[model samples]
Target: MPLTFEDLLARARALPRLGHRALLGIAGSPGAGKSTLAEQLVRTLNGEGEPWVAHVPMDGFHLADVELDRLGRRDRKGAPDTFDAAGYAALLRRLREERDEGGEVVYAPGFERVLEQPLAGAIAVPPTARLVVTEGNYLLLDTGAWSRVRAQLDEVWFCAPDEDERVRRLVARHEEFGKSHQEAVAWVLRSDERNARLVAATRERADLVVRDLVGWPDRHGRPRTGGEPGPVGTDTGC
Candidate 1:
């Protein structure tokens, strides 16, 4: 049986503080609400008086438009190969080691959707942050560049939603990002679906599996209980 969102939160909060830092990876299919859940967790934890939480997204490591063009992978922009996975892993390692010594700001890269380029130093993870919540599509991917990422995290949570809902959200997301409805549907069926299948297979590796009930509480803000809610709608660019 899968745990509810609240169960996942409690599990994360219970992690022992490491001398270095804590890295929490939230992974899921393309439209399975991983980014939304991650953001909600950070916000909720901060609001509840945990101020040391920060976010470092994998999408931030996507290659620049020119590089993608050179590699001829622009059309398949969200594919695993489209990102600089090794660089991302290196940054995670650095984050675990670099304390707040000398007030040096740890600059991390970020991907720009509208501009379709990766900008270095777009995000800075301060040393004061004790909990880093990183979310993406390939965190648990077992092959290639993604394999290194899983080993760097203290814990990993996999989000699972109904397939119909996931597809609906993906289509909506694509359309919201300026794709035509037809194009969005096609992309969801062609690219996003493929990625989702790959992601779904990694659930067994997660420390916890979260099933977003339809009417469940706004697990981030207040407390309520019911069927799982519709998938969380958020555009964290992952």
Candidate 2:
């Protein structure tokens, strides 16, 4: 059975009393709505203005564009090798171990899509935060640097959406990001599809699988549950 959004939030709230920082991983293939869901979760959790959670996205650790071009990997920008996974792992460790010293703040990395570069110290994880929700593509990947990502998380959620809808969203995202329609399609078919396959293989490893949000109803106009919808392509081509 699929877990409701409120159920997931309750799970997150329970982790803080366990004496260590809770690392909730939100991972999925390109355009799988990982970021969107993470944002919604944080907003919902902090809507009362307590600010108990902070988001640490893996995309923030992506290597700068010049570095990718230098390494001749520009064509594979979203590949696992294109990110500073080790650095991300290290930060996670720090976030878990360091005790809150009142006003002390820890700076982390962030990625800039328009500039195609990684901005250093762009994210600040405050000492008081109890839940650190990190979202990215390779959190559950079983090999290389990605393998270590999951071990650091208290729980991991894999977000899956309908296949045709996912592809449509990806194409739209590509177009919004300045890719020509043809280029977008080619990228989806080539790069995004490859990553999607890799991400899908990790679903069985996830602690929870999330379904995309739905509205209205089908032909009958009955309210639909957002949890158990349909199988979607596991492509998070961010």
Show model 2 residue runs off by greater than 4 Å. Answer: 101-103, 215-238
Q: What is the TM-score of each candidate against the true structure?
A: 0.86, 0.87
- Residue pair clashes in candidate 1: 213-227, 213-228, 213-229, 214-227, 214-228, 214-229, 215-227, 215-228
Clashes of 2: 7
The TM-score leader among the candidates is 2
Query: Where does model 1 exceed 4 Å of error?
Result: 1-4, 16-18, 100-103, 215-238
lDDT of 2 by residue, 1-238 (tens): 4445566667778877545678899888898878777876777777767788998889889888889999999999898889988888888888877666544687888877667678889989887788989998889898877777888888888888877778888998899878999999999998998988888998888887776545323223244565423222232222
- List model 1 lDDT by residue over 1-238, tens digit each: 4444556567667663755678899888898877777877777777777487788888899887788899998878888998999998998888877665554568888767667577888888887777789999899888987899989998887777777777887898788878999999988888888878888888888876666535434545555444334233222222
lDDT of 1 at 7: 61
lDDT of 2: 0.78
